[model samples]
Target chain A: MKSTTTWINSINNRFWRTIVNSTATGVESVAVFRIIMGIYLLFVTTPTYTWIADLPKALYTPPIISFVNLLASDFPGRNFLVTVDFLMVASIVGIVLGIYSRFATLAFVILKVSVLSFQYSFGKIDHDIMLPATLACMAFSGWGQTLALVPDKRSKWDSPSKSLSVIAVLIGFGYFSAGIEKAIHWLNFDLNSNGTARWFYLGLYNLQRQPILAPALKNAPFWFFKIMDVVGVIFELTPIIAVLISRKAWRIWLFFAAAFHLVNYLLFNINFIGNGLVYIAFINYKPVYRYVANLTKSYIAKALILAAVGYAAVIRGISILTSQNVGIIFIPDNGNANLYCMLIIWALICAALFITIFKTGKQPVHDDLEVVSPQLT
Target chain B: MHSLKFTGILFAIFLIPFVLRLFGLEPYPAILFPSGPETVKQVNGKTEIETKQLFAKKQNGQWALVEPKAFMYPVSAIQLAKLVSKNMGFKKQKPFPLKGKIGIVNYLYRSQNSSSSAAEEAELRNWIKKRLKRGNYQTSEVKVATYSNIISTTNGNILKKELKDEKYYNLD
Candidate 1:
């Protein structure tokens, strides 16, 4: 009896310690997440300027103002919207530079939500949601402290552990909700019109409107899809499980997760790159960070990272400019040339990432990036 | 903020909403997944390829096909789609007779929770009724119909018997 009680007590202690200190060693990984988030958000929101600039004259009634009776019927006009666009750009810069990161993040949250409310006021709401959610978490976390050009030095509450802990839980919770929703869907599956998983699967295939892939998916054996759907439900729940398990289990789960996303992308053109990228928060990247830091100690690594970032920026700018008349001087003259440029850019990024991760001959890369949770009374 | 306070605040933000969820109070629509499954609408019959363009408005006490923009000013065909999804339903409208002079609005609606939300339906109808009344069209009876395909709007004078020929409201 005493032995069992002691074992239970030790387990309880260990669990809390893991929760409290899971983030102590994820500063570098969290930094990478922050930088990726900043760049992605800027790229994502760049297209909104055209619509935002026409808000005053645009037909759809902006949100919040619609339900309220006393708000202004007349809009403030396109110039005012231009000011909003300019401010958004400035905030994006701040997010990237890590200068006043908290403020920039808050500004981003408010601005993005405010504009999105207007943009979708007429009704399509699911586009580009991951960025805002990501930005809000980073704003809540002190992620800018490590990787920013000018790191915020507020030491009181900006510990890596606290910041990362908050982010990890949020991500875990997000995926868990998705998994739960799927379960709820299947719960009513029996009562649905056709009363089977086939209807549910067909609904998911965009009502058989999936042009290229629909025929194959339809022709596949019914048992095949039913089993895949069941597996998908379990896999979706694995994200939350990943957060709760040991580091080794978490890594294994994430590997399967990457595969799941890839398969979904192929089956449906629904690429959730932004959502997938945020999962890096759970990884212990101390070794990766250390290697990069060491490599940066040599000028070659510094130049390489800078080159990667620069190439990434130019590619981003060109893609955005080509799609919209953003008034940029340099435009991709042709689609084939632009595609080639993108491939080269990706290759460069991969080379930089590979060298930073494995090129340092001082030590071999190991799979033991586990962080020890400190016992706290 | 001290570390404990920081931790406390963060957890509070997470937990309060969770507790609210337990009590059946969903958080404000923000950066999160739907609290429940957002089932993608599936229509069995031939559906209009461009859904937002198909709409039927009640004019002169008769349901007639009309352009969506006539009712939802400035809402693009795509924007109209966003509005139809209950989850994406846009809030806020310009105050004065929201989209003035438009009466007896008509548009395609694909909503996940519309079947269950009678109160939501009543509230919207009342709002639209008030708007239509101000625009000099006496209107009554806001009824919603779901159909798989709405081929095209017929000419203003088409008889009710001709609706089948126009492919309007042809539910499978």
Candidate 2:
């Protein structure tokens, strides 16, 4: 009994230590997520920009139209969808700027809910379903102090950490709900063919729509997909246990989830919400500050040199390769080539910022408050 | 600490593909899977006709036969699923208004009709005809419900009988 008590005590200390030290990382993560989500929302809304407009008609079908036909008059339409898109863009902007965060969060919820309702009208779901719930949590939790519209409050009582904890709980709940859904829908409980597991495979392996994987998936020699499905369902169902196990474990999960989104983005051209935001909820803000400060002090110089080399190599490589391609050479001059050029230019600008920061080195800056939870007492 | 060789190998694995893609590695096939209009074909089948358009397939395997007409818009999976689920009565038929460059046409539709028209059916059909004309497809006779049960916006020419011969497009 004494040994067990001692072991519990050690685990408790380690958990708290990890939480406290990682505060800055949390703040940085929130900033990055807010900005990315903001820009992504903005980019998706601008329909005149056809690249993002590459979409299919089936997505606009409202899942609730039949129910609505029986129950309400609301059916998904282009104008209705456009309005939701506009609201989403505004909310993302609000989130990024930290302006009127609660209002932005609320607006985000309203717009996303309508969109979700439309989506739910069809029986399909994606990770974005959790965004509204996360926003609901953010409405209570104040991530804005670090990267938001409001000025930082003087007291610990109003610190973003309190709100962040709530956000953390919400994040956990989002995973938990999905996990529970798998549990409730027992067919999805298995690792191989179950719902969450299937998506992970389909989304990552680029088989979400194609019928080719159907045969291999159904009649595979090994139960590789089956194991994946089971593990995913278990992880999603009991994420609190999985999440609370260790920060490293949580980070690993986040990494896989992010990779899942990235694959969807690149392979299927599907955009998913919560790809970056989940990382924000998992952030422990204090360590981020320390890490940034340390980087400001030490590694800036190295990062610049690496960035320069990467840029030159990439540009030269592109020029050489595309020059020899017969098909690419004859194509009508689409704007993509120039667009990539702009991307490289911005990359160089980022590299320059890195150099500037490293050359100047770090100056002593005032420290942000460390979160000390009252619940711990 | 990790060894330098391992780190170098890791960086190389990450860097090489990106480099290759930048240099016209051409990740996807150059020849786009041709559009439906280009490849619309008539299937020699009974009961169901099939239209071979991109994203959607007609039952009889002919693009020209499904009435009122159908088309598709690329949408997020969430939206696609929601649309499919909301319009769940795949077997139930209801009169729906459809528009083309020609004009509005009323047609009875079942869920198996297609998702494009359900969302913006007319627009999608127009787009498919315009954009994806390369895929195999064919035109076929579409079943038309009598307009006698409804109001007419044109000259109030009351049809004396159910006009089965009224020209209608069908996609299998």
The numbered model that scores best in TM-score is 1
Q: State each model's CA lDDT, in order.
A: 0.45, 0.38
lDDT of 2 by residue, A211-268 (tens): 3233344333223544544555565545344345544555555555555444334333
Tell me candidate 1's TM-score on chain B. Answer: 0.35
Runs with alpha carbons beyond 4 Å of true place in candidate 1: A1-16, A20-24, A43-45, A53-77, A127-130, A140-142, A187-212, A290-377, B1-31, B34-80, B83-172
- TM-scores of all predicted structures: 0.58, 0.47
lDDT of 2 at A159: 31
- Model 1, backbone clash pairs (residues 3+ apart or across chains), number: 13
Worst 10 residues of 1 chain B by lDDT: B105-114
| lDDT at B24, model 2 | 30
Worst 10 residues of 1 chain A by lDDT: A364-373
True contacts kept of each: 0.12, 0.05
Error of 2 at B73 (Å): 2.6
